[model samples]
Target chain A: MRFKWSNVVLFFGYLFLYFPLICIVIYSFNESRFVSTWTGFSFKWYKALISDPIILRATVTSLKVAGVSATASVILGTMAAIIIARWGAFPGNTLFLGAITAPLVMPEVVMGLSLLMLFVGMESFFGWPSRSGNITVIIAHITLTLSYVTLLVQARLQDLDNSIEEAALDLGASPLKVFFVITLPMIAPAIVLGWLLAFVLSLDDVVIASFVAGPGSTTLPMIVFSSLRFGISPEINALATILMTILSIAVIMSAVFIYKDGNIKNM
Target chain B: MYRIEEIIISWFSELMKKIKGRHFLVAIPYGWVFVFFICPCLILIRISLAENLIASPPYTSLIEWISGYMLQIRINLGNYMVLFTDEMYIRGFATSILIAGTSTICCLLMGFPMAYAIARSSEKIRGILLMLVVLPFWTSFLIRVYAWIMLLSPCGFINNLLIRLNLIEAPLQLMNNSCAACIGIIYAYLPFMIFPLYSAIEKIDYTLMEAAYDLGSSPLKAFFSIVVPLAIPGIYAGSALVFVPAIGEFVIPELLGGAQTLTIGRLVWNEFFGNMSWPTAASLSIILLIFVVFPIVFAQRRREAKLSIVD
Candidate 1:
């Protein structure tokens, strides 16, 4: 292939994107506590990170919130996607679309503030969900991540062939049965992708979690944000390295799976 | 027991039959969004008009019952007035727009070529390239911003290398500045800009470019005249994606912009968390929402108009 100017820009662009991440990964193993100086390789920081109780508890909370929020977002988003793509225009369709897409562009600070107010209002009125906790954080995350899931599934649904579902329905299958047996399987990949996206979004959230979470509940990002105020720490580097490693693996596996699925469909 | 169970099942089935499947599907998500998303925004607006209080909720109710058959309503415009009159709040909003706009332009410049290259590549490599762009996004956003801290700090990698090479007498003042914040924002949001641009560029008819080239147009001329014009939608989409979130980005500005930089996000965060003034924070949020939502609604209306015209 002939060399082009675009290739040079692309090369530098990718380097710019990956260089900082790679620096963190390499420095995580540095024996020196300071992030700049590299002495020798050691896993001592990793051990320290593992032993930190705050990090561990925060991680557990983050995982639980991410799992539940992602599942809920996927279900709700899929239903919304189906309605938008398959149900045709209906009353309040414009409002529905606006609400679905608003979160995608909404500022995190605004979203957090508004949701916190809602929870506080609910508490005063109903005297339930007495305070912000994991439940509140989960609800906030579900709202935040729902838009992403809906957009993904909606794109997939629009591209889908409707004749297969129609054929199933004509074959004396109930609409519910046709949805389960035919449509769901066809859109399963998109659903899975949406779930993973939501999970990552929830896990990565700090601003919203900080607003909605009470003093009793702290997620991993909140802990990291607090520690980061003291400047760079080797433990954060270790934690970042671990998170990056797991995320890289998950992303690569999903990419490969999607690519393979596409190839099979082409065949 | 059997008779009761049968009756209950039949009633439930009858109720299900009464609700059409499509309505049920629509109601589930619509109701969730209405309660969680819409209600919160409405409450935010209401609270923005309420007076600050020292009570647990921290904001006084807007409406009160003075007596039987009598009503009293209190609307505090002071919260919004503070946002407009206070130097800190005004500067915060100005700095946020300026920084977010600058970073968005940088993202466009940096992402365009990368997106174009990926779009022009072979199909096999295209998928991989797209995956590469999306991979970093899945990792921690805070960690990514923190990575810039490690890179741009005085004792960080770049400075260390420069000092070792005798390139400078002292480390440059790179960290804790607006420039660093811009760089961090650009790095973090470049992928967002590229995805929309790539999708748009990929759909362009290369034949049009070829046709322009055949008409004695220079390659650069052809690119500007043909490719750029066609990619306007993508540019708008990508710019919106980058600019909106960048304006309210608390982490990047807080970490990279240092104490000197006063973005709206940090202002709201401080007002809410530091001062514990819920009304002021709510007012800030409402203003920020107006800044964000109005442009989006305008764009959607324009697009709808365009579509209707085509139809």
Candidate 2:
């Protein structure tokens, strides 16, 4: 009886979760301009996407920002993980930790506004950053994203055998050599997962980008927001479907890797 | 082992011998936070105190504390006074709080059952079920909103189907209102609610629940007395995650709420970029910041407490 009830609950649960997504995917091949009535299937939307210059430009810009932001975030995050998790943590460490984690919980509007205010202040107080632009956006992304890298790397760091570094040190290798040769390689997989997460988040982020991006800076979600004024577009369905595919795969894989230990006994 | 340790230690000591600026290791994250996050937040507090002017950005003097409280720009308490004095900002803030709170409660309501189901399912089935929940959110969010439009529209799917079934003669006007916005908000944030709850449910000891049953308690009592309290950590985490974002939410409300609805998030967006009232937007944002920063910062501290435990 208990099992039967759980099955029923699970059925409804899955239905609620997937209904809209499945609708969108089905409608991606949708022929009607009206997102509702299904006339017939066509690849026209996919084809139209190739020819749309604005979306194409936005896609490229998004890719560039994600790439740059992810790389920068990963490096800093790795350093943070190493310092805080692997090696010597400074005094009052958790406060520094709190500041790092603050961005994840900080409302998007607050983050964007605060960043804009900061840039404005910098321009006035020091005459540095004389004007606000992509530099500000990149900096904002870095501040937010680095924490993800740090958190992921820190989790990985805690599971690592510290004695490995000791062994390398005992073998006549210096701390720098031990880090590069031993610690870096061991945490490489986690670093990759962290980088991928940072990249995808950077791409999907609309709220922050809308506020701080430079002139003519059209990220994918930003364009999506502006075009939303026009109601639903078939091409958007195609774009969203693709992004969904990529992000899902990244999320699943990361969870699989990160959650490996929890399933160890079961496996 | 002793000889090997001696050799390894000496070689590592040689490598560290030349490296300087060990402090740089700590400097990067510290420097970035100070210049970017901490200082900027402090600066915003300062700017919020300033008076507004048209010609200049945030036009007003920096500090007019206890003595010069009347001057609008000279750190007068006017912005804050206006925040209290005007009902619009107050109402807007209230609306944001109410909507976000409702949405978070709704998430908990819908998500707990689903998460429990996922937790109790067979391993293979659980994987597939979990995938289904996450897969939709992975899709285009806007398109999903559009999907709701189709379902809720007068001539759309749900209406059409209902009419065809003779369930109702007239189609209900569903879209372009607060109700639609609520549906959309819940729809969008559902996955967030589910994931945290699911993970938490997975961690629960089934034996404990069974023990409650064996104690002759009713299933209802078992759920309320045993299952719910144990899941509080996940519930808190999920609500914080959902509520914080939902409070600042603009895209969903703007897209679905149509013309009738007004939200603090949309209000802020409109004030800055929409109305081009940059100073007002800045001041409003400062107000929004006060409300958001307090709960959100407090929540993170609580989260870190659990997080260290999880690790």
- Chain A TM-score by candidate, in order: 0.95, 0.89
Clashing pairs in 2: A169-B8, A170-B8, A170-B9, A171-B8, A172-B8, A172-B11, A173-B12, B51-B73
TM-score of 2: 0.86
Candidate 2 wrong stretches, greater than 4 Å: A88-92, A123-133, A250-267, B1-19, B63-73, B137-146, B153-156, B163-171, B293-311
Per-prediction TM-score, chain B alone: 0.89, 0.78
Residue-by-residue lDDT tens digits, candidate 2, B133-207? 866765556666767765776666677778878998898887788778888888888889888888878988989
Best by DockQ: 1
lDDT of 2 by residue, A1-267 (tens): 878888887777777667766666777888887654789999888889889999999898888888999999998898888888865557758778878877876767767877877887677778866433456667888887988888988888888889989988999998889989999987877788789878877877788888888676768888988876666677877776677777788777766765663532221
**Stretches > 4 Å off in candidate 1:** A263-267, B1-17, B20-23, B298-311
